[model samples]
Target: MPSMVLLAEYVSINGTDLSDYCRKAELTTKVEEKDVTTYGSAGWKELRGGLKSGELALEFLQDVSASALDSIMWPLLGTVVTFEVRTDQAVVGTSNPKYTGSVLINGWNPIQGSVGDEAKTSVSYPTSGAVSRATA
Candidate 1:
């Protein structure tokens, strides 16, 4: 049997819950492929896995409050920060099917629009190390 996990679950950054302000979030992992095709080999190309990398993207309703801007901006502008994504809308650490890791803030963009539009921010970062996955 197979089960589905909803996207409207828990999400946190540096142990702080940000699900309320978060509109979209995604974590992607990829591996670099190295071509290993050599002479006297088959006509088809061959590849070998080289390195692994990860990236995270988040979209949030822009807020200028201390907890919203100050908290996130400082880390994004300063150093690597930890983030966690859970399967349920509970406290981060208390939930299952979680992914946690540290990442360096790569880019941040605050968007502003005319009337009848909500302000938002989009940020993305590249993972520095392994992103641990937990299912229980």
Candidate 2:
């Protein structure tokens, strides 16, 4: 594998492509660690993988106009929406895999900034269902 600079990452939420407005994006998957150590163990602790979960976080350059970031995300609050992310805007293949999942829009910060700071909205959404990776 080679290094990635990620200049044209792709992000889509609820079927709307927000790649242009997205400043940052991340998709994370985690598995709960299950302790399997028993009294028979002398010193070593055993562990195994348990349930798996995922999350998608995004930071966007704020835009509140019609059909913009704010408009697209506001209505989806408290609901689970489909999302897809890719390393680049190109088609998904062996090199560029697409991650798709349903995320619960638990919270949103529409406006957050300081003087001279760029307007931005950052959201971290928990996956409501299984996350899938496709290279097709």
Candidate 3:
């Protein structure tokens, strides 16, 4: 399969670096793919090698400017939903010819999803069930 490094930290992205959105985090603090199953699927792991791992050239961003981007990618990801997408058999990005490190989305949102199986999102525990998914 593919390999990826998911470092969740506060990050600023500029339109130029959209392809390779780097994660800013302490090397000691890492979220392994195995642990992610508690929330989402393992498919997201490939992101590490494509660009986050410093493998390919990427466009870096400093702020969230929606109109400036070729497209709006953030909206695609459910506010807090996860979906298991149908991927190729092998390590898709590595073996495939077209690869850059950008997370592909459906128009503006992510093609996969943000929550559990089939993208039925759960309320954020932090908000006391106040947070919910917005369908477009």
Report the number of the highest-TM-score candidate: 2
**Alpha-carbon TM-score of each model against the true structure:** 0.81, 0.96, 0.18
lDDT of each: 0.78, 0.93, 0.26
The better-scoring model by lDDT among 1 and 3 is: 1
Cα RMSD (Å) between model 1 and the true structure? 2.9
Q: Model 1, poorest ten-residue lDDT window?
A: 87-96
Minimum summed lDDT over a 10-residue window in model 3 is located at 120-129
Candidate 1 local lDDT, 66-125, one digit each (tens): 767545665566478898877677544534578989988766665556788888777788
Worst 10 residues of 2 by lDDT: 1-10
What does candidate 2's lDDT look like per residue over 58-81, in tens digits? Answer: 999999999888998999989999
User: Residue 94 of model 1: what lDDT?
Assistant: 39
Pull out the clashing pairs in model 1. none
Clashing residue pairs in all predictions, respectively, total: 0, 0, 15
